[model samples]
Target: MEMALCNIKNPNELWSLESCDELEQYGITISVCTDIFSTTILWMEADNNDGDPSVFLNHFLDTVTRIGGCPQRLMVTPSRENEHIATTQTFLRRNHTDCYAGEDSVMGGVSLRSHMWIHTCTPWKICFADLRELGHFTGKDLDKNLIQFCFLHIIQDHLEEFVGRFNKNISDHNILRSQDDGPAEDKLQAVLPEDIEVCRRRCTPRGRYPCDETLFEYWELIRTENGWEVPVDRFTALKLYLHLRNVMETCIDEEEQVTCIDEEEQETCIDEEEQETCIDEEEQETCIDEEEQETCIDEEEQETCIDEEEQETCIDEEEQETCIDEEEQETCIDEEEQETCIDEEEQETCIDEEEQETCIDEEEQETCIDEEEQETCSDEEEQVTGLLQ
Candidate 1:
C-alpha cells in the first residue's frame, strides 16, 4: 500500500469525521492550525495521527487566553522572548484594572484599551489615563492634530474671554479683525470656584477628573516650570502664537509690494526727465544753427554794400578826369586867339609908317622943285651975265 499525506487548506472550511474517514481509506493523513483573530488556517502533515484533535484544540485555546494572545510574544526569538513576554503581561494587568492606586503602582499601569472602554461606557469622562502612566508629555508628544483639537475646544469655551482680553469687539460689522488690535493676553482665566468645588466633591484631588479646572491648573503649573505643557487650557497660548506669526508674515508681504511699486514709479520719473532733457538739447541746437545762418546773411549783405560803394567811387574818378581834360583844351584855344591879335596889330602899324614915308617924299619933292626954280633963276642970271661978257 502506498502511504499518502494531505493537508486541509482553510480552517474556515467545513471539517467532518466522514471526510477524515475517506482520507484514511486512501492512506492519507491531514492536520490543521487556525488563528482565531485573523480567521486563517495552516496545514501540515499529521505526524502523530494517533491522538484526538479535540483535546489539542482545547489546550491551544486555554494557552492563548493565558498569554493574552499577544502575537509579538509568540513571534519573538529566544534572545528577545523575555522582554516580549514581560510587555504582554503588563498590558494584560493594566487591561484588568480600572485605575492605579498611586505613583508606585503606575509601573505596568492601566492601558489605553481600558480607558477607551471606560470612555465608551461614560462618554462625558475626559480622563488623561496615559498621563498618569507617563507623568507628562510635551513637544514631539503634542502633534498638530492634538493641538488643533485643543484649539477648537478653547474657541468653543473661551472665545468671549479671548476677544475681551485683546480688546477686540467681534461685531457683525467687523468680519475679520484688523491688525490694529493690540497684543493678546498671556494668561487665561482659571475655572470658576463652583466648578472646582463640584469636581472636588465628585472625585479625589489626585485622581483623574473630567472638569476644566483640574486640567487648566495642571497645565499652568507645568508651564510655569518647564515652559512646555500639554493643551490643557484649550490651547489659548498656542492660538495666540499662531495668530501673531500670521500677522507678522502679512505685514512683511505688504511692505515688499510697496517697495516694488515705489521703485517702478521712480524709474518712470527718471525716464521722463531724461526725455525732457534731450528735447531741450535739440531745441538749443536748432536755435544756435538759426543764429549762425543770420550772421552769415548779415556778412554777405555788408560785402555787397562795400562792392557797390567801390563801383560808385570808380565812376566819380572817371568823371573828374573828363572835366580836367576839357578845361586844358579851353585854355589852349584862348592862347591861340591872343597870338593872332598881336599879329594883326603889327600889320596895321607897318601900313601907317609906309603912308607917312609917302607923304614925306611928296613934301620933299615940292621943296626940291622950289629949290630948282631958284637955282634956275640964279643960273639964268649967271647965264645972262655970261652972255653979257
Candidate 2:
C-alpha cells in the first residue's frame, strides 16, 4: 500500500535519496526517496526542523524499516551533508545494501538525480507560503504548533496531489532524455558549448562510474531473471497507485479544502501542472531558455491573438470581445458598437452606433457629435472648436 519501488528480496532494485530545504519561514525541511528508474518519489516527509542531519537519518531508517529493510542498493545525495550521508551509507552497507554515496558511481548517485530536485522544491515552498499568507500565520509571537496544526495536513494534501500529477504526467523527450550513445550529454553539450569538456569528462564512463548501457542492461536482466512485476509505463504506475490508495484508505481530508481565494471572482487557480513548472524567481529563471519568449497567447481565454511579427492584434468580436491595437492606433468593438472609432488617418472622431442620428459629419471634417449628443467642431489642423449645440 506504501509508495515504494524497491523489493528487498530482489538483488537489483535501487533507489536514491535527496533532502532539500522547504518552508524556511516555518522551520521545515523535506527528504524524499525516488525510484532511480521511474523517477517517482517513493517516500517523503516535511517535518524535519533546523536541517539537522540526524532527523534525516531517523526518517531514512523509518522508511527502510517500513519497506521491510535493506534494498538491493541505495544512493544518498547532497553529499555536502557528510554526517547523515555517511551514517545512512554505513547503515545500508551494514545491512548488505550496496551503498552508492559521495562521488562514487555516477549511475546510482549525485549529478543526474540532483536535476530533479532543482525545480521541485520551489513549487512546494510557494504552496506553503500561500497557505501561511492566506491563513494569516504571521506575527512574531505566534505559536509554532498552531501554525503546523493549521498547515501540515493541508500541505500534505498538496504534496499528495503534486505526487499524483507528477508521477502520472507523461514525460516529453527533451535534451535530458536518456540514451545509449550519450544523446543526453551530446544535446547538453550542443546547448551548453562552454561546458562541453566538463560534460565529456563526467558523462564518459571511467573507473567506478558505469556506462548507461551497463546500468540499463543490468536492470533489464534483473527484472527478467526474477520475473518481478514492475510498472512498465507511467499509465501502469498511475493505475497501481490509485488501487493502492483505495486499498490503504489514504485520502485528503475534507477540511483540507480551505479556500485560498473568493470562489466567484477567482479567474484561475494555480493547478498542479502550473506549480510544478512555474518559475517566478530570478535564480530559477536561469534554467529557462533565453531565446524563447514566454508570451504564449491563450486564444481560448482572450478571444484575440497577437501576431507579434506583423505587429497586429487580431480580434474576433463575435463574442463581444473588445480589443485595441496600439501599433495601428485602432479600436475594435463588437458589431453592435462598430460606429465608435477614432480614426487617426483623417483626424476624424466617431460616434456610438447606438445613436448614429446624433453624429453629423461635416463636409470639411470640421464638425463632430459626441456620444452625449453634443455638437463639436474640429479645425483643419485637428483642433477641437468646442461648439455646443
Candidate 3:
C-alpha cells in the first residue's frame, strides 16, 4: 500500500504534529529532524514498511525547498528521533549522519532565534537586509529567522566581549534609568556653587592672576556628560580640592618671592644710605683735621713773632712798650683758636646724633616691612584654608 500523509506543504504546518504515534497508526513512523543549520525542524519518516525511507525523506525535503525553505535549512539532518520524545541528547549524538559535516559553520546565527524565544521575555526586531549590507550576513537572500538568529548571536558575542574585556557591571536598564534622571549639568551646578565661590576668591586679588574659571567649566562638562555625579565620591572630591589648593599655593609662593625681593631691595637701599653717611662722617673728620693743622700753624707763627719782638726789645733796650703790645696780640690769637676748636667739637657731636637718628629710622623701616610681610603671609594662609574648606 502507498500512502501520502496529509499533503503538508510547509514546515510550519508539519511542525504541528504532536506525536509520532499519530502518524504511526497509519504505518507511517514519523521523526522530528532538524535541518543542517538547525534553524528549524522538519518532519520525515524514519521507517516505511512498503517504501524506501530515503525516498520519502528526500521528497519531504524537496517539498520544503519548493515551499521556499533554503537548502541550508533543509539539507541532511544531524540526528533524528521520534517526534514525541526528541531531545537535545539525540541531536548531539555522533551516530547521526551529517552530525559533524558543518562543524565550522556559524551555529550562533542558526540557533539565536529560537533560543531567544525560549530564554528571553523580550522580542527584538532586526532587519536582515541591513545586516547583509553591513557585511554581517554573506548569504544571498537569507531568511528572516536566520537574520534574527544572526543578529542575536552578534549581540551575544559583543556583550560577552564587552563584559570580559571592559569589566563593566552596568546594564541596559541602568543606562535607561540614568537618561531618565535628566541632564547632569543641572545637577552639577546645583551642588558646586559653594566650592566655585571659594575657588574664585582664592584665585582673585591674592593670586598673581585670576583663577581659571574654564577649569571648573571643563570639569563640569566632562563630569556631566560622562555620567559622574555632583558631590562626587570622597576620593575624587579630595583630589579636586587638593588640585585647587595646589594652585593657590603656587600663587602664594610667587607673591612671597616678590615680597622677599622687595625686602631685599629695601635692605640694600638702607645699606647704601648707611654707607653714604659713613663717607660723609669720614669727610667731616678730614675737614676737622685740616682745620686743626691750620690752627697749630698759626700758633707756631705767633710764638715765633713773640720771640722776634723780645729779641728786638733786647737789641733796642728802650722799645719795651712795643714788645708788650706784640705779646697781647699773641694772647688774643690763642683765645680765638680755643673757641674755634670748641665749635668744631660741637659740630662733630651733632653729626654723631644725626647718624644715630638715621640708624633708628632704618630699624623702624625694617620692622614695618617685617610686619607687612607677616600680614601678607597670614592672609595667604587663610585664603588657602578657606578654599580647602
**Best-fitting candidate, measured by TM-score?**
2
Higher-ranked by TM-score: 2 or 3: 2
TM-score of each: 0.23, 0.33, 0.20
Task: Please give, for residues 1-389, the per-residue lDDT of candidate 3 as tens digits.
Answer: 01221332222221221113222222223333333211133433323222333334343334333444322212222223212121211221213343322221112212222332222212222232343465543542222222222222333333344334322333343355457754222100011234323323322121121113454454446556756444323234334333433444576699999999999999999999999999999999999999999999999999999999988877776556667777777877877788888888888888888898888889998888888899988888899988999
What stretches of model 1 exceed 4 Å from their correct place?
Answer: 1-296, 354-389
**Winning candidate number (lDDT):** 2
Model 1 agreement with the true structure over 122-186: per-residue lDDT tens digits: 31112222322343222232222222223434332342343243233323222232234433222
Model 3: which ten-residue window has the lowest total lDDT? 183-192
Backbone clashes in model 1, listed as residue pairs: none
The lDDT for every candidate, in the order shown, is 0.39, 0.43, 0.41
TM-score of 1: 0.23
Better of 1 and 2 by TM-score: 2
lDDT of 3: 0.41
Q: List the pairs of residues colliding in candidate 2.
A: none
